[model samples]
Target: MTVALSLGATANLGHAQNTLNVATWGGAYGQSQEAAIFEPFAKETGVSIDTVTYDGRLAKLKTMLNDDGTVVDVIDVSADALNTLCKQGLLETIDASALGAGPDGSAAKEDFLPGALSPCGVASVAWSTAIAFDRKAFPKGAPTAISALLDTAGFPGIRALPNNARYSLELALLADGVPPENVYRELATPEGADRAFAALDKITGAVRLWNKAQQAITWLVEDDVVMAASYSGRLFRAAAGDRNIDILWDGQIYDFDAWAIPKSSDNKKDALRFIRFATVPARLADQAELTAYGPMRKSAFPLVGKHPVINVEMLEFLSTAPQNFQKALKFDAAWWRGNGAALQKRFAAWRARVNAARTDREAARKAKEAAEKEADKAAP
Candidate 1:
């Protein structure tokens, strides 16, 4: 059961209101949060919590921060966004002293993963963009490496890739034989950008772009595409029900999702309370059991044992698992913050050209078939 709060009641309400409004990426992720974090905090403190979804757009967040009567109290954002927002002074700097210690009484700062805690944000989960493919689609052989995704001749079928340049560029560079450690360095240069785009050109004919994470898994299950780049957690949930779907941990791009509060939020006290309660080692472990995302707290690992619903061990499926994590790349938040806009413009232009070419080809194919039918009629 998903915990869904009515947006109508939360909107147009000022900080003077009693409820705490949280922005999250809704769907299974939101559901896990509702079960493991929000619901428990609300029950314990009697604080009314309202949840809303966003596309992780910075403009929407900036608008909310600029408004004195904004309803948003806390938001879940990416590390790159958190860094950028913190630097811009749009987010409230969290008081480390107020966060307290972990369940084991260890220092909070020491318990979290390295670089997990920022001036204005704290990480909730470590997630990744991984390759997921349908087992049945590749009967003779399956794609086991990142390069297979770009090798259309070897594995022919529709490929679903994210519309964004962040992960797409990294994967393209990696497929083009760029070393994991050097990916961001290469992406930072004009020549590297050209190389990444050139690599993408090879598979443009077979690629289908998806704007949302869930759509990647849906496209695979529906057979709309044979292979898809998806969030590891989303693919895990879908794979739990459909045995044929499996994730390739190789070359996965790992990153964290952080919780941040707008500087102008009226409910900072309650928001802090919720964040503290939710980040407790036990609570973080509970969330991991509900979803495949790895907890940011190192103490949460020992507590994360099994899937709350499926009874399967959750560690093996996590992106941070020892065996699975070996071949993955850490997403460079600073690099993206510096180069995102320029690369995004390039990516948009390339996608538009590819889409237009595909449209022309489809139109020409239809026109030729019609002309052939008319010729057949005349011959008869």
Candidate 2:
């Protein structure tokens, strides 16, 4: 008997067995990963898979959960979004036991990173948020630590910071000499956020906030800004494009993108099957190669040296060196899920204040230039 699905479900419950839909963040990376791995799986399993873009995924998932018969099945999101979905009961718990099959018909769990094979989601890719500087612009070595980026007195140049409060604030605190391990605990209080903001205030005059990834990449490439805290993937692209950019692996923040099955799906088994195939080491490696993202599977590390996406030599300079990997502050997705909204409000207010100050400075400078020009004309 065919498995009974919720009425009006999007799952093809007919002769077409493996057809499914996947929701992912849109970009060249998404398209490449889909074509390389997900599309191939569709052909192998006789499934016709469709891919759609869902940016700002957490808010989208919440809307889908509230409405029944939502079409989304498999979703690719940041670790923070995954945790938020899991906590909101928007994602189905996955059973990895069913996915293991090998030469000896054993589970593939051993091939992946420990704690990564979660019941609700699995970290599919690893990438770093690091300090990237244009070598020609700075000429000196890239800023080594977060503190170095924060040090305007020594390193005087315009810098880019993400508009997001959580990670940005964490970096600010880290630059202020807050021990990495103590960052999260300290960020829990208003006083802590104040300190982070105050530290950031020192560089406020020198900062340009980048809200979108593409904008950040363009900024780095055009030398619009000398140095920006950006994703490792973007840095790879910049380096590959012959831009004289170097990444400071010291104090780099690492984050993961995870695959999750939404709880509102009509076909849990099919979703799990797709996720399993997607997470397979070979497939994961291919996706990483196509997307320039690092693979989460431990077995995929060796493949890293071969991929054009990674800077193999730069890997030696990683802040995530085995000893320091644990030292980097892991994003607290749970806190983000609970307090993200409020924090965003606070961040917006702060940003507005910064913008106003910048506007005033620019207006004053323009006024002074106009006055100087008028005086020169009158004297002549």
- Among these predictions, the greatest lDDT belongs to 1
lDDT of candidate 1 over 113-157, digit per residue (tens)? 777788899998889988989889888898888898899888888
Candidate 2 regions with alpha-carbon error over 4 angstroms: 1-16, 62-73, 88-90, 99-111, 263-267, 305-327, 337-380
Predictions in order: lDDT: 0.84, 0.70
Per-residue lDDT tens digits of candidate 2, residues 150-219? 8887777778889889678878888898987788777778888789888888887777788886677788
Off by over 4 Å in 1: 1-27, 45-56, 71-73, 95-106, 139-141, 152-156, 211-215, 222-224, 265-270, 305-313, 330-380
> What does the lDDT come to for candidate 1?
0.84
- What shift in Å separates residue 189 of candidate 2 from its native position after superposition? 2.3
Total clashes in model 2, counting residue pairs 3 or more apart in sequence or in different chains: 0
Deviation in Å, model 2, residue 358 alpha carbon:
4.0
The C-alpha TM-scores of every prediction are 0.75, 0.76
**Number of clashing pairs per prediction, in order:** 0, 0
